[model samples]
Target: GLKGPENWGMIEELASVLGAATACSKPVSDIGWRPHSEHVGQTGKPVAANLYIAVGISGAIQHIAGINSSKVKVVINNDPEAPFFKVADYGIVGDAFDVVPRLIEKLKEFKANNA
Candidate 1:
């Protein structure tokens, strides 16, 4: 599940900037933190996106199964040994709270410079 809904604003902003659709693990949707429509997993909606960015998700087998079709997978979690890292094309080990803000800033900077 995600760290908390408080940081979802920045997460959504970043996804918007990247033109990416947001999805979440089943638990997130089950807990009513995110809409079930946004849930992606074996029992949820299937994702075949070009890129999947998973944040704060522990990457259960069911969760990973849904996203296996993605061309690229990026995982950001505080746990270095998270199962998600095993399958991620790129893995960042850190707190999403600390990392997401910096990532949003960098993405904004890149967009400003490129635009």
Candidate 2:
């Protein structure tokens, strides 16, 4: 589970760089780490994005239900048994701290090269 608000900065940065919107789990919003408007779950907002990347969020039934409409789902988590893997199009089992920064750097490099 996420320790604090500091962990979200990288996630927000990645989302910004990817031109993707950032959303959090119900627990994160409830803990005041994110606004309710940014929460995604059956009890929160529903997601229908073409690409959805979930970081450090274990899939709850409610959360999965909301994002089920997304065309593609990618999950990044340390837990190999996270339920999110069941529905994800791709899964990266690793520490978000270690993975996200590298992913952002690679995406930035790819964008620059492709541009």
Candidate 3:
């Protein structure tokens, strides 16, 4: 999967940090940058994640259907009413670019302390 090379390091770190695999939405995967296996959608691969975090995604009905079964759904988008919030167990209505980094930092800090 090649959504972007920028996040692979972080993904690798976090996967180890949380014991999770990396996945992306069809819209991002369709760009040919990401592998088909990375697609998560009603028409694509179905997922039942323990913690599904959607950042910068609009969370369309089609997309949500695939992820709705997750034990925890967290959405971060600038739009106050991105519609994803309705299905999310927790949501942050803000710029994902800003929120994601902060979240990563916090998680890293917590991981460091816990370790």
Best by the TM-score measure: 2
Which regions in candidate 3 have their CA more than 4 angstroms from the true location? 1-16
lDDT of each: 0.89, 0.93, 0.77
Tell me the TM-score of each prediction against the true structure.
Answer: 0.94, 0.97, 0.84
lDDT of candidate 2 over 1-115, digit per residue (tens)? 5579988889888999899989999999998999999999999999999999999989999999999999999999999999999999999999998999999999999999999
lDDT of 3 at 83: 84
RMSD of each: 1.1, 0.7, 2.9
Q: Write the per-residue lDDT of candidate 1 for residues 1-114, one digit (tens) a residue.
A: 346777678779869888987888898888888899999999999998898999899999999999999999999999999999999999999988888888988988998999
Model 3, span 10-112: residue lDDT tens: 5555556677887777877787646888889898888899998887678888899888889999887888878888889999988755666677788889989
What value of lDDT does candidate 1 attain over all alpha carbons? 0.89
What number of backbone clashes does candidate 2 have, counting pairs of residues 3 or more apart or in separate chains? 0
Order by lDDT, highest first: 2, 1, 3
lDDT of the structure predicted as candidate 3: 0.77
Clash counts per candidate, in order, are: 0, 0, 1
